[model samples]
Target: MLLERGVTDAELQAEANRIAVKVESIFSSYLAGSGDGRDRLFEAMRHAGLGGGKRLRPLLTVATGRLFGIAEDRVIRAGAAIEAIHVYSLIHDDLPCMDDDDLRRGKPTVHRAFDESTAVLAGDCFHDLAFEIIADTATHEDPFVRAELVLEMARASGPNGMAGGQMLDLVAEGQVLDMGSITRLQQLKTGALIEFAVEAACIMGRLPPEARTPYRGFARDIGLAFQIADDLLDHAGDEAVAGKRLRKDAHAGKATFVSLLGEDRARQQCSILIGQAIEHLEHHGEEADLLRAVARYVEERDR
Candidate 1:
């Protein structure tokens, strides 16, 4: 269903790589201040933030923006901002007090790379930097529109959204949860950000209201589907194959779709969600191609 936009998975990945490198360079430039603490901070930040992710959020932003005729450079700037925010979340999530995870994206977690203090500050800094990037890039032409992007991302990233979801997940660990609660937590924790990524693109691209809503919904469902696959991978995946340790969530007593639904059923749910996500694209006609491919890949990606 995807790739109707004349781009292959390999091509998408290539574009993602170029954008990723550019994003890092921009991030590095932003961090160029003279001080030992700054150096330590960047070391921890780069340790966890640089390289590894498929940069799917930013890629979605770029691709969706193109659908609305937004300039590619502007979309890339928006993507870079969100990707940085994402990296910030990961840094904090892996802290000793949070997930307590020692590794991520096939390498040592930020705290392990540097120290807990540095990691904590680095994460905090990155989140703020996200808004700066967005605001800086979006300030001209339509200031309100550009500012709206920051507001949407802040809401998604803040305590009422992703952060709140993380706190809920922490509290819910080892406690039995109904399907609704499980789904709600995952939706907020992960789906909100994915929604932001899509919405950010739409907003950046200046897509019409009606079109953006459905696409953001598509992104939300895809995010949930992607999380389900992640939960399953943790149970059935190899560390090397998955690029992160397996069975960590289980070991930590983290409640997940896999634990609640079992392997087969979790996989089934993912398939169903992917179907729903693709169905949202039907109105796009040809524009839906990239989205459909991305939805499928979310379900099937190994890492």
Candidate 2:
């Protein structure tokens, strides 16, 4: 299969690294303070929010915004807000009541580093901060744009999206799930925020809803592909490189794409999805090189 090419792995990593720095800086600024009784909460927030990861969601936001000629600074702020939500989700996901994870990004999980209550509060604060950043005039001057961003973020993170998918995931433990059920579970748990990342750019660009069909297609495809790749990683990827535990799904008797389809078929499916995702960008030109690179990266990343 011939893939569209412009950006190299080094270039993509460089760009991701740059975005990571900027987003972490934003978290630092938002989290900076002292002399309060809530200092531990702030420290926990900083620990989780500032910890480095792929930062893929924010990268998508910025890359999509670039397609619309949006200002980089403005888009970066919006991306930072989305990443804040992502970090918040990770914090909660790692809690004892949730995934019960001990390590994240190769370091102690927030609950382990601090305490369970502090981790919970830090996650809550980050959730609130996500909306605070989005609703602030700094993200966008237009009230309507800010409002739309808030609405989408809420839906993506609320009961209908990530949280709902998580519920489904928990329920599926030790139960048999068909392909459709597993797909839907991942779409909500993983895809919703990814879709929001792209849609946010459309909102900022003021693109009409009707014209966003292709971008939506692109987001949906890559989102599923990303999750499949994650499942593959869990099935066979190196835990040291992944910076966390793997095979927990299998251990818990949860059905995943890799578990259902097996390794070869699952990898093929990811390739097909990445190809379809890039096809959605057919109308775009060189300016979309980063987005194309991202789609391929989603399929090829080790962690």
Best by lDDT: 2
Root-mean-square deviation of each candidate, in angstroms? 2.2, 1.2
Please, what are the lDDT tens digits per residue for candidate 1 over residues 1-303? 443445577866676688778777767767775576578776666676676777888877776776677777777777888888889999899888888887788898888878888888999999988888888844353777778888899899888789988998989877888889989998889888888888987776677678677787788889999899989889888788777768988887877899889999999999998988887777666554565666778888888
Question: CA lDDT of 112 in candidate 2?
Answer: 98
What clash pairs does model 2 have? none
- Residue 171 local lDDT, model 1: 92
Clashes of 2: 0
lDDT of 2 at 198: 92
Against the reference, the lDDT scores of all candidates come to 0.81, 0.90
Error of 1 at 88 (Å): 0.9
Clashing pairs in 1: none
